[model samples]
Target: MSHPQAKTHRMSEFTESIGTVTFSGIPNEGFLALGMRNYWDGYFAGRAAPLGLAPAEVVHAVFYNFADGEVARHIPWVWGKTTPEEAIAVRERGSAAALRQMIGDLADSSGLARAADLATRAAVSAPIEGRALYAGLRALAVPEEPVARLWHAATLLREHRGDGHNIALAAHGIGGTEAHVLCALAHGMRPEEFGRIHHLPKPQLAAVIDGLRDRGLVNAAGGFTDTGRATRERIETLTDELAAPAYDVLSVAELDELIAGLEPICAAVDAAGD
Candidate 1:
Protein backbone atom coordinates (compact mmCIF):
# COMPACT_ATOMS: atom_id res chain seq x y z
CA MET A 1 0.00 0.00 0.00
CA SER A 2 1.34 3.45 -0.93
CA HIS A 3 1.68 6.16 1.70
CA PRO A 4 -0.78 9.01 1.01
CA GLN A 5 1.90 11.74 1.22
CA ALA A 6 4.22 9.76 -1.08
CA LYS A 7 1.33 9.30 -3.52
CA THR A 8 0.58 13.03 -3.50
CA HIS A 9 4.26 13.81 -4.06
CA ARG A 10 4.42 11.40 -6.96
CA MET A 11 1.40 13.03 -8.63
CA SER A 12 3.00 16.47 -8.31
CA GLU A 13 6.19 15.08 -9.75
CA PHE A 14 4.29 13.69 -12.72
CA THR A 15 2.65 17.04 -13.40
CA GLU A 16 6.00 18.82 -13.23
CA SER A 17 7.50 16.23 -15.53
CA ILE A 18 4.95 17.00 -18.20
CA GLY A 19 5.43 20.72 -17.65
CA THR A 20 9.19 20.52 -18.12
CA VAL A 21 8.84 18.68 -21.39
CA THR A 22 6.07 20.91 -22.72
CA PHE A 23 7.68 24.16 -21.67
CA SER A 24 11.47 23.83 -21.47
CA GLY A 25 12.45 21.44 -24.28
CA ILE A 26 13.64 19.07 -21.59
CA PRO A 27 12.82 15.50 -22.53
CA ASN A 28 10.71 13.41 -20.15
CA GLU A 29 13.51 10.92 -19.48
CA GLY A 30 15.79 13.67 -18.30
CA PHE A 31 12.99 15.18 -16.25
CA LEU A 32 12.61 11.97 -14.30
CA ALA A 33 16.35 11.82 -13.62
CA LEU A 34 16.39 15.45 -12.49
CA GLY A 35 13.32 14.97 -10.32
CA MET A 36 14.86 11.95 -8.66
CA ARG A 37 18.14 13.73 -8.05
CA ASN A 38 16.40 16.77 -6.64
CA TYR A 39 14.22 14.62 -4.46
CA TRP A 40 17.19 12.81 -2.96
CA ASP A 41 19.31 15.92 -2.55
CA GLY A 42 16.56 17.83 -0.76
CA TYR A 43 15.49 14.91 1.44
CA PHE A 44 19.05 14.05 2.48
CA ALA A 45 20.19 17.61 3.13
CA GLY A 46 17.10 18.60 5.20
CA ARG A 47 17.16 22.06 3.67
CA ALA A 48 14.31 24.22 2.44
CA ALA A 49 15.33 24.45 -1.23
CA PRO A 50 13.95 26.84 -3.82
CA LEU A 51 14.41 24.36 -6.66
CA GLY A 52 13.47 21.50 -4.33
CA LEU A 53 16.98 20.16 -4.96
CA ALA A 54 20.62 21.07 -4.58
CA PRO A 55 21.53 23.57 -7.30
CA ALA A 56 24.70 21.83 -8.30
CA GLU A 57 23.05 18.43 -8.51
CA VAL A 58 20.11 19.80 -10.49
CA VAL A 59 22.43 21.46 -12.99
CA HIS A 60 24.38 18.25 -13.36
CA ALA A 61 21.24 16.28 -14.11
CA VAL A 62 20.17 18.85 -16.67
CA PHE A 63 23.53 18.80 -18.41
CA TYR A 64 23.66 15.04 -18.56
CA ASN A 65 20.11 14.58 -19.77
CA PHE A 66 19.53 17.18 -22.46
CA ALA A 67 20.68 15.79 -25.81
CA ASP A 68 20.36 18.94 -27.87
CA GLY A 69 23.95 20.12 -28.37
CA GLU A 70 23.08 23.80 -28.64
CA VAL A 71 21.48 24.02 -25.20
CA ALA A 72 24.29 22.01 -23.69
CA ARG A 73 26.95 24.11 -25.43
CA HIS A 74 25.44 27.32 -24.09
CA ILE A 75 24.62 26.16 -20.56
CA PRO A 76 28.19 26.11 -19.29
CA TRP A 77 28.74 29.70 -20.34
CA VAL A 78 25.27 31.10 -19.63
CA TRP A 79 24.03 29.54 -16.37
CA GLY A 80 27.27 28.28 -14.83
CA LYS A 81 27.39 31.07 -12.25
CA THR A 82 23.74 31.79 -11.56
CA THR A 83 23.41 32.09 -7.82
CA PRO A 84 20.20 32.18 -5.83
CA GLU A 85 20.78 35.91 -5.26
CA GLU A 86 21.06 36.59 -9.00
CA ALA A 87 17.92 34.56 -9.66
CA ILE A 88 16.05 36.66 -7.08
CA ALA A 89 17.20 39.91 -8.70
CA VAL A 90 16.03 38.67 -12.06
CA ARG A 91 12.63 37.87 -10.60
CA GLU A 92 12.36 41.36 -9.12
CA ARG A 93 13.13 43.11 -12.41
CA GLY A 94 10.47 41.33 -14.52
CA SER A 95 12.87 41.16 -17.50
CA ALA A 96 11.90 37.58 -18.28
CA ALA A 97 8.28 38.35 -19.15
CA ALA A 98 9.32 41.20 -21.41
CA LEU A 99 11.73 38.87 -23.25
CA ARG A 100 9.03 36.26 -23.80
CA GLN A 101 6.73 38.84 -25.30
CA MET A 102 9.53 40.13 -27.48
CA ILE A 103 10.28 36.60 -28.72
CA GLY A 104 6.63 36.09 -29.56
CA ASP A 105 6.60 39.34 -31.49
CA LEU A 106 9.76 38.36 -33.35
CA ALA A 107 8.21 35.05 -34.29
CA ASP A 108 5.22 36.74 -35.82
CA SER A 109 7.19 39.45 -37.56
CA SER A 110 9.82 37.10 -38.97
CA GLY A 111 7.31 34.39 -39.92
CA LEU A 112 9.38 31.91 -37.93
CA ALA A 113 6.82 29.44 -36.62
CA ARG A 114 9.40 27.20 -34.95
CA ALA A 115 10.75 30.08 -32.93
CA ALA A 116 7.19 31.11 -32.17
CA ASP A 117 6.37 27.62 -31.01
CA LEU A 118 9.46 27.56 -28.81
CA ALA A 119 8.43 30.90 -27.33
CA THR A 120 4.91 29.63 -26.70
CA ARG A 121 6.32 26.53 -25.04
CA ALA A 122 8.43 28.76 -22.83
CA ALA A 123 5.38 30.86 -21.96
CA VAL A 124 4.00 27.93 -19.98
CA SER A 125 6.63 28.72 -17.34
CA ALA A 126 5.58 31.96 -15.62
CA PRO A 127 4.40 34.11 -18.58
CA ILE A 128 7.50 33.50 -20.76
CA GLU A 129 9.67 36.43 -19.57
CA GLY A 130 11.17 34.60 -16.62
CA ARG A 131 12.17 31.80 -18.94
CA ALA A 132 13.67 34.37 -21.28
CA LEU A 133 15.71 35.86 -18.45
CA TYR A 134 16.93 32.40 -17.53
CA ALA A 135 17.93 31.85 -21.12
CA GLY A 136 19.67 35.25 -21.29
CA LEU A 137 21.67 34.46 -18.20
CA ARG A 138 22.93 31.34 -19.91
CA ALA A 139 23.85 33.34 -23.02
CA LEU A 140 25.80 35.79 -20.85
CA ALA A 141 28.16 33.04 -19.78
CA VAL A 142 29.37 32.45 -23.33
CA PRO A 143 32.45 34.44 -24.44
CA GLU A 144 31.18 37.66 -26.00
CA GLU A 145 33.81 38.53 -28.63
CA PRO A 146 33.39 35.44 -30.79
CA VAL A 147 29.60 35.70 -30.69
CA ALA A 148 29.62 39.43 -31.37
CA ARG A 149 31.98 39.11 -34.34
CA LEU A 150 29.90 36.34 -35.89
CA TRP A 151 26.78 38.45 -35.53
CA HIS A 152 28.44 41.51 -37.08
CA ALA A 153 29.75 39.55 -40.09
CA ALA A 154 26.36 37.89 -40.61
CA THR A 155 24.57 41.24 -40.55
CA LEU A 156 27.02 42.80 -43.01
CA LEU A 157 26.86 39.80 -45.33
CA ARG A 158 23.08 39.74 -45.18
CA GLU A 159 23.04 43.40 -46.15
CA HIS A 160 25.68 42.93 -48.85
CA ARG A 161 24.44 39.57 -50.16
CA GLY A 162 28.05 38.51 -50.92
CA ASP A 163 28.37 41.26 -53.55
CA GLY A 164 31.39 43.54 -53.18
CA HIS A 165 29.82 46.46 -55.09
CA ASN A 166 26.62 46.15 -53.12
CA ILE A 167 28.68 46.31 -49.96
CA ALA A 168 30.46 49.36 -51.31
CA LEU A 169 27.18 51.07 -52.26
CA ALA A 170 25.61 50.28 -48.90
CA ALA A 171 28.63 51.53 -46.96
CA HIS A 172 28.65 54.69 -49.05
CA GLY A 173 24.90 55.20 -48.94
CA ILE A 174 24.33 54.48 -45.26
CA GLY A 175 27.59 55.90 -43.99
CA GLY A 176 26.78 59.36 -45.42
CA THR A 177 30.43 59.95 -46.36
CA GLU A 178 33.07 58.58 -48.74
CA ALA A 179 35.41 58.05 -45.80
CA HIS A 180 32.91 55.86 -43.94
CA VAL A 181 32.15 53.82 -47.08
CA LEU A 182 35.85 53.25 -47.60
CA CYS A 183 36.22 52.11 -44.00
CA ALA A 184 33.39 49.58 -44.32
CA LEU A 185 34.87 48.22 -47.57
CA ALA A 186 38.21 47.75 -45.86
CA HIS A 187 36.46 44.98 -43.92
CA GLY A 188 36.50 42.59 -46.89
CA MET A 189 39.69 43.38 -48.82
CA ARG A 190 43.32 44.54 -48.58
CA PRO A 191 44.22 48.23 -48.87
CA GLU A 192 45.94 47.81 -52.27
CA GLU A 193 43.12 45.56 -53.50
CA PHE A 194 40.44 48.06 -52.46
CA GLY A 195 42.44 50.89 -54.02
CA ARG A 196 42.73 49.04 -57.32
CA ILE A 197 39.03 48.08 -57.38
CA HIS A 198 37.63 51.48 -56.36
CA HIS A 199 40.41 53.90 -57.44
CA LEU A 200 40.45 55.85 -54.14
CA PRO A 201 43.48 57.86 -52.97
CA LYS A 202 46.05 55.47 -51.41
CA PRO A 203 46.69 57.69 -48.36
CA GLN A 204 42.97 58.05 -47.59
CA LEU A 205 42.43 54.28 -47.92
CA ALA A 206 45.36 53.58 -45.56
CA ALA A 207 43.88 55.90 -42.97
CA VAL A 208 40.49 54.18 -43.16
CA ILE A 209 42.07 50.73 -42.75
CA ASP A 210 44.13 52.01 -39.83
CA GLY A 211 41.00 53.35 -38.14
CA LEU A 212 39.10 50.07 -38.65
CA ARG A 213 42.00 48.07 -37.22
CA ASP A 214 42.04 50.33 -34.18
CA ARG A 215 38.33 49.69 -33.73
CA GLY A 216 39.12 45.90 -33.69
CA LEU A 217 36.62 45.20 -36.49
CA VAL A 218 39.41 44.63 -39.02
CA ASN A 219 42.87 43.07 -38.68
CA ALA A 220 46.40 44.31 -39.54
CA ALA A 221 46.58 41.71 -42.31
CA GLY A 222 43.45 43.13 -44.01
CA GLY A 223 41.33 40.03 -43.41
CA PHE A 224 38.73 38.88 -40.88
CA THR A 225 40.28 37.79 -37.58
CA ASP A 226 39.33 35.03 -35.13
CA THR A 227 36.84 37.35 -33.51
CA GLY A 228 35.27 38.10 -36.86
CA ARG A 229 35.02 34.40 -37.75
CA ALA A 230 33.26 33.67 -34.45
CA THR A 231 30.89 36.58 -35.04
CA ARG A 232 29.93 35.18 -38.44
CA GLU A 233 29.44 31.69 -36.98
CA ARG A 234 27.16 32.93 -34.20
CA ILE A 235 24.98 34.86 -36.66
CA GLU A 236 24.62 31.84 -38.92
CA THR A 237 23.82 29.64 -35.92
CA LEU A 238 21.10 31.98 -34.74
CA THR A 239 19.51 32.25 -38.16
CA ASP A 240 19.59 28.51 -38.68
CA GLU A 241 18.38 27.75 -35.17
CA LEU A 242 15.47 30.14 -35.54
CA ALA A 243 14.55 28.71 -38.95
CA ALA A 244 14.94 24.98 -38.25
CA PRO A 245 11.92 24.37 -35.96
CA ALA A 246 9.62 25.89 -38.58
CA TYR A 247 10.92 24.21 -41.72
CA ASP A 248 8.68 21.16 -41.42
CA VAL A 249 5.67 23.35 -40.93
CA LEU A 250 6.12 24.79 -44.39
CA SER A 251 5.66 22.49 -47.39
CA VAL A 252 8.17 22.11 -50.21
CA ALA A 253 5.67 23.78 -52.52
CA GLU A 254 5.32 26.68 -50.12
CA LEU A 255 9.09 27.13 -49.84
CA ASP A 256 9.39 27.09 -53.60
CA GLU A 257 6.68 29.72 -53.71
CA LEU A 258 8.67 31.85 -51.30
CA ILE A 259 11.77 31.44 -53.48
CA ALA A 260 9.71 32.35 -56.52
CA GLY A 261 8.42 35.46 -54.74
CA LEU A 262 11.94 36.55 -53.74
CA GLU A 263 13.65 35.92 -57.11
CA PRO A 264 12.17 38.94 -58.88
CA ILE A 265 13.14 41.31 -56.07
CA CYS A 266 16.69 39.96 -56.10
CA ALA A 267 16.87 40.21 -59.90
CA ALA A 268 15.56 43.75 -59.84
CA VAL A 269 18.14 44.78 -57.27
CA ASP A 270 20.93 43.22 -59.34
CA ALA A 271 19.60 44.73 -62.58
CA ALA A 272 19.32 48.18 -60.98
CA GLY A 273 22.95 47.95 -59.96
CA ASP A 274 23.89 47.13 -63.57
Candidate 2:
Protein backbone atom coordinates (compact mmCIF):
# COMPACT_ATOMS: atom_id res chain seq x y z
CA MET A 1 0.00 0.00 0.00
CA SER A 2 1.11 3.54 -0.69
CA HIS A 3 1.57 6.22 1.93
CA PRO A 4 -1.60 8.20 2.47
CA GLN A 5 0.10 11.37 1.19
CA ALA A 6 1.97 9.64 -1.61
CA LYS A 7 -0.07 11.29 -4.37
CA THR A 8 0.34 14.68 -2.78
CA HIS A 9 4.02 14.11 -2.17
CA ARG A 10 4.74 13.16 -5.75
CA MET A 11 3.04 16.20 -7.27
CA SER A 12 6.24 18.25 -7.44
CA GLU A 13 8.31 15.38 -8.82
CA PHE A 14 5.77 14.52 -11.50
CA THR A 15 5.21 18.10 -12.58
CA GLU A 16 8.91 18.94 -12.62
CA SER A 17 9.91 15.85 -14.58
CA ILE A 18 7.45 16.46 -17.40
CA GLY A 19 7.86 20.19 -17.31
CA THR A 20 11.67 20.12 -17.57
CA VAL A 21 11.58 17.63 -20.42
CA THR A 22 9.28 20.03 -22.22
CA PHE A 23 11.47 22.96 -21.30
CA SER A 24 14.97 21.56 -22.03
CA GLY A 25 14.69 18.51 -24.22
CA ILE A 26 13.90 18.29 -27.94
CA PRO A 27 12.35 21.75 -27.79
CA ASN A 28 15.91 23.01 -27.63
CA GLU A 29 16.07 22.29 -31.33
CA GLY A 30 13.41 24.91 -31.84
CA PHE A 31 15.42 27.39 -29.78
CA LEU A 32 18.48 26.72 -31.93
CA ALA A 33 16.34 27.12 -35.03
CA LEU A 34 15.29 30.47 -33.55
CA GLY A 35 18.96 31.49 -33.79
CA MET A 36 19.92 31.01 -30.19
CA ARG A 37 23.55 29.84 -30.10
CA ASN A 38 23.83 28.38 -26.60
CA TYR A 39 21.93 26.85 -23.66
CA TRP A 40 22.11 30.01 -21.50
CA ASP A 41 20.98 32.15 -24.41
CA GLY A 42 17.86 30.10 -25.01
CA TYR A 43 17.25 29.44 -21.32
CA PHE A 44 17.26 33.09 -20.25
CA ALA A 45 15.37 34.19 -23.33
CA GLY A 46 12.72 31.49 -23.49
CA ARG A 47 11.87 31.42 -19.79
CA ALA A 48 12.12 35.17 -19.23
CA ALA A 49 10.12 36.17 -22.31
CA PRO A 50 6.89 36.22 -20.36
CA LEU A 51 8.30 38.97 -18.17
CA GLY A 52 8.71 41.16 -21.30
CA LEU A 53 12.37 42.01 -21.72
CA ALA A 54 12.86 42.23 -18.00
CA PRO A 55 16.13 43.65 -16.73
CA ALA A 56 18.78 41.30 -15.35
CA GLU A 57 18.15 42.40 -11.77
CA VAL A 58 14.46 41.56 -12.06
CA VAL A 59 15.19 38.20 -13.68
CA HIS A 60 17.79 37.46 -11.07
CA ALA A 61 15.38 38.31 -8.27
CA VAL A 62 12.65 36.06 -9.63
CA PHE A 63 14.87 33.17 -10.73
CA TYR A 64 16.49 33.30 -7.25
CA ASN A 65 19.24 30.68 -7.56
CA PHE A 66 21.50 31.71 -10.45
CA ALA A 67 25.01 32.94 -9.73
CA ASP A 68 25.27 36.72 -9.36
CA GLY A 69 25.31 38.50 -12.72
CA GLU A 70 24.76 35.26 -14.57
CA VAL A 71 21.27 36.35 -15.54
CA ALA A 72 22.58 39.82 -16.43
CA ARG A 73 24.79 38.29 -19.10
CA HIS A 74 21.77 37.14 -21.09
CA ILE A 75 18.43 38.74 -20.27
CA PRO A 76 17.93 41.91 -22.39
CA TRP A 77 20.36 40.52 -24.97
CA VAL A 78 18.06 37.59 -25.59
CA TRP A 79 15.12 39.97 -25.82
CA GLY A 80 16.92 41.72 -28.69
CA LYS A 81 17.25 38.39 -30.46
CA THR A 82 13.64 37.23 -30.05
CA THR A 83 10.33 38.78 -29.13
CA PRO A 84 8.41 37.31 -26.17
CA GLU A 85 5.48 36.32 -28.35
CA GLU A 86 7.79 34.62 -30.81
CA ALA A 87 9.66 32.76 -28.05
CA ILE A 88 6.43 31.61 -26.48
CA ALA A 89 5.14 30.46 -29.84
CA VAL A 90 8.16 28.30 -30.51
CA ARG A 91 8.07 26.98 -26.97
CA GLU A 92 4.58 25.64 -27.46
CA ARG A 93 5.35 24.33 -30.92
CA GLY A 94 8.55 22.70 -29.78
CA SER A 95 6.92 21.15 -26.74
CA ALA A 96 4.11 19.85 -28.91
CA ALA A 97 6.58 18.37 -31.33
CA ALA A 98 8.66 16.79 -28.58
CA LEU A 99 5.63 15.25 -26.91
CA ARG A 100 4.36 13.90 -30.19
CA GLN A 101 7.72 12.44 -31.05
CA MET A 102 8.15 10.90 -27.63
CA ILE A 103 4.69 9.48 -27.17
CA GLY A 104 3.85 8.65 -30.78
CA ASP A 105 0.38 7.07 -30.94
CA LEU A 106 -0.51 8.10 -27.40
CA ALA A 107 -0.59 11.70 -28.49
CA ASP A 108 -4.25 11.48 -29.42
CA SER A 109 -5.56 9.54 -26.45
CA SER A 110 -8.71 10.69 -24.63
CA GLY A 111 -6.97 10.07 -21.31
CA LEU A 112 -4.42 12.72 -22.20
CA ALA A 113 -7.24 15.11 -22.91
CA ARG A 114 -8.73 14.49 -19.52
CA ALA A 115 -5.35 14.82 -17.88
CA ALA A 116 -4.84 18.09 -19.69
CA ASP A 117 -8.15 19.35 -18.38
CA LEU A 118 -7.33 18.38 -14.79
CA ALA A 119 -3.84 19.78 -15.03
CA THR A 120 -5.15 23.00 -16.55
CA ARG A 121 -7.57 23.38 -13.70
CA ALA A 122 -4.82 22.92 -11.15
CA ALA A 123 -2.54 25.40 -12.91
CA VAL A 124 -5.19 28.05 -13.33
CA SER A 125 -6.40 27.67 -9.82
CA ALA A 126 -2.97 28.13 -8.20
CA PRO A 127 -2.70 31.40 -6.33
CA ILE A 128 -1.07 34.17 -8.36
CA GLU A 129 0.15 36.42 -5.56
CA GLY A 130 3.98 36.50 -5.35
CA ARG A 131 4.25 33.92 -8.09
CA ALA A 132 5.72 35.97 -10.89
CA LEU A 133 6.54 33.20 -13.35
CA TYR A 134 3.40 31.20 -12.75
CA ALA A 135 1.20 34.27 -12.97
CA GLY A 136 2.76 35.35 -16.23
CA LEU A 137 2.35 31.91 -17.77
CA ARG A 138 -1.22 31.58 -16.54
CA ALA A 139 -2.06 34.80 -18.38
CA LEU A 140 -1.52 33.20 -21.74
CA ALA A 141 -4.20 31.16 -23.48
CA VAL A 142 -4.07 27.43 -22.86
CA PRO A 143 -3.20 25.53 -25.98
CA GLU A 144 -5.97 23.98 -28.04
CA GLU A 145 -3.98 20.86 -28.86
CA PRO A 146 -3.98 18.17 -26.19
CA VAL A 147 -0.24 17.53 -26.14
CA ALA A 148 0.64 21.18 -26.04
CA ARG A 149 -2.04 21.74 -23.48
CA LEU A 150 -0.58 19.06 -21.21
CA TRP A 151 2.89 20.48 -21.62
CA HIS A 152 1.72 24.00 -20.92
CA ALA A 153 -0.19 22.86 -17.88
CA ALA A 154 2.89 21.05 -16.63
CA THR A 155 4.98 24.16 -17.20
CA LEU A 156 2.49 26.30 -15.35
CA LEU A 157 2.39 23.99 -12.35
CA ARG A 158 6.14 23.72 -12.44
CA GLU A 159 6.58 27.46 -12.27
CA HIS A 160 3.93 27.68 -9.60
CA ARG A 161 5.81 25.25 -7.42
CA GLY A 162 9.14 26.89 -8.22
CA ASP A 163 7.91 30.23 -7.04
CA GLY A 164 6.78 28.64 -3.83
CA HIS A 165 10.18 27.03 -3.46
CA ASN A 166 11.89 30.39 -3.76
CA ILE A 167 9.68 31.70 -1.03
CA ALA A 168 10.52 28.71 1.14
CA LEU A 169 14.23 29.16 0.53
CA ALA A 170 14.03 32.83 1.38
CA ALA A 171 12.14 32.26 4.60
CA HIS A 172 14.85 29.85 5.69
CA GLY A 173 17.50 32.57 5.17
CA ILE A 174 19.35 30.64 2.49
CA GLY A 175 21.18 32.64 -0.18
CA GLY A 176 21.43 31.49 -3.77
CA THR A 177 24.93 29.97 -3.69
CA GLU A 178 24.46 28.52 -0.24
CA ALA A 179 21.21 26.96 -1.36
CA HIS A 180 23.03 25.30 -4.27
CA VAL A 181 25.65 23.90 -1.90
CA LEU A 182 23.04 22.54 0.43
CA CYS A 183 21.16 20.99 -2.45
CA ALA A 184 24.32 19.35 -3.77
CA LEU A 185 25.30 17.99 -0.38
CA ALA A 186 21.78 16.68 0.19
CA HIS A 187 21.77 14.95 -3.21
CA GLY A 188 25.29 13.48 -2.83
CA MET A 189 26.61 15.82 -5.54
CA ARG A 190 29.88 17.69 -5.23
CA PRO A 191 29.05 21.30 -4.55
CA GLU A 192 31.49 22.37 -7.25
CA GLU A 193 29.81 20.24 -9.86
CA PHE A 194 26.38 21.62 -9.04
CA GLY A 195 27.70 25.17 -8.98
CA ARG A 196 29.42 24.66 -12.34
CA ILE A 197 26.13 23.54 -13.86
CA HIS A 198 24.78 27.00 -12.97
CA HIS A 199 27.96 28.65 -14.34
CA LEU A 200 29.27 29.74 -10.98
CA PRO A 201 32.99 30.49 -10.98
CA LYS A 202 35.39 28.36 -8.98
CA PRO A 203 36.27 31.16 -6.58
CA GLN A 204 32.64 31.92 -5.88
CA LEU A 205 31.81 28.25 -5.43
CA ALA A 206 34.71 27.82 -3.03
CA ALA A 207 33.58 30.80 -1.04
CA VAL A 208 30.04 29.48 -0.80
CA ILE A 209 31.25 26.06 0.32
CA ASP A 210 33.50 27.63 2.88
CA GLY A 211 30.66 29.67 4.26
CA LEU A 212 28.49 26.57 4.50
CA ARG A 213 31.25 24.73 6.29
CA ASP A 214 31.66 27.60 8.76
CA ARG A 215 28.01 27.32 9.57
CA GLY A 216 28.51 23.57 10.03
CA LEU A 217 25.99 22.96 7.26
CA VAL A 218 28.61 20.99 5.36
CA ASN A 219 31.35 18.69 6.63
CA ALA A 220 34.98 18.22 5.53
CA ALA A 221 33.94 15.61 2.99
CA GLY A 222 31.63 18.11 1.31
CA GLY A 223 28.53 16.36 2.55
CA PHE A 224 25.75 17.69 4.73
CA THR A 225 25.94 17.44 8.50
CA ASP A 226 22.82 16.50 10.38
CA THR A 227 21.67 20.11 10.59
CA GLY A 228 22.37 20.61 6.90
CA ARG A 229 20.32 17.60 5.93
CA ALA A 230 17.50 18.67 8.20
CA THR A 231 17.57 22.18 6.76
CA ARG A 232 17.27 20.96 3.18
CA GLU A 233 14.48 18.61 4.17
CA ARG A 234 12.68 21.44 5.92
CA ILE A 235 12.91 23.66 2.86
CA GLU A 236 11.66 20.86 0.62
CA THR A 237 8.85 19.98 2.97
CA LEU A 238 7.80 23.60 3.19
CA THR A 239 7.95 23.86 -0.58
CA ASP A 240 5.64 20.89 -0.87
CA GLU A 241 3.28 22.45 1.64
CA LEU A 242 3.29 25.70 -0.29
CA ALA A 243 2.72 23.77 -3.53
CA ALA A 244 -0.29 22.03 -2.03
CA PRO A 245 -2.83 24.67 -2.95
CA ALA A 246 -2.44 24.07 -6.66
CA TYR A 247 -3.10 20.38 -6.40
CA ASP A 248 -5.82 20.96 -3.86
CA VAL A 249 -8.07 22.13 -6.65
CA LEU A 250 -8.31 18.54 -7.73
CA SER A 251 -10.00 15.85 -5.67
CA VAL A 252 -8.14 12.71 -4.65
CA ALA A 253 -9.67 10.76 -7.52
CA GLU A 254 -8.93 13.47 -10.08
CA LEU A 255 -5.34 13.72 -8.89
CA ASP A 256 -4.89 9.98 -9.29
CA GLU A 257 -6.31 10.07 -12.81
CA LEU A 258 -3.95 12.86 -13.80
CA ILE A 259 -0.94 11.05 -12.36
CA ALA A 260 -1.86 7.73 -13.91
CA GLY A 261 -2.53 9.43 -17.21
CA LEU A 262 0.88 11.10 -17.28
CA GLU A 263 2.98 8.24 -15.86
CA PRO A 264 3.31 6.39 -19.16
CA ILE A 265 3.93 9.58 -21.06
CA CYS A 266 6.70 10.39 -18.60
CA ALA A 267 8.04 6.84 -18.94
CA ALA A 268 8.05 7.15 -22.71
CA VAL A 269 9.97 10.39 -22.52
CA ASP A 270 12.42 8.77 -20.12
CA ALA A 271 12.77 5.76 -22.40
CA ALA A 272 13.44 7.99 -25.39
CA GLY A 273 16.27 9.55 -23.35
CA ASP A 274 15.08 13.01 -24.18
TM agreement with the true structure for every prediction? 0.24, 0.94
Q: Tens digits of per-residue lDDT for model 2 on 103-187?
A: 7888898988898899898889988999998888988999999888988998998999899889999998888768877877666
Give model 2's TM-score versus the native structure.
0.94
Clashes of each: 10, 0
**For candidate 1, lDDT tens digit of each residue in 1-274?**
1122332232222222221111121221222333323322212121112232234444433222122232333333323334333433332222222223223333133333332232222222211121222332222222123212222222222212112222333432222122233333446554465432245566755665666567564577766556545544454333333223222333445534433432332233224324
Indicate the residue-level lDDT of 5 in model 2: 51
Off by over 4 Å in 2: 1-5, 195-199
Report the C-alpha displacement of residue 81, candidate 2, in angstroms.
Answer: 1.4
TM-score of candidate 1 against the unseen true structure? 0.24
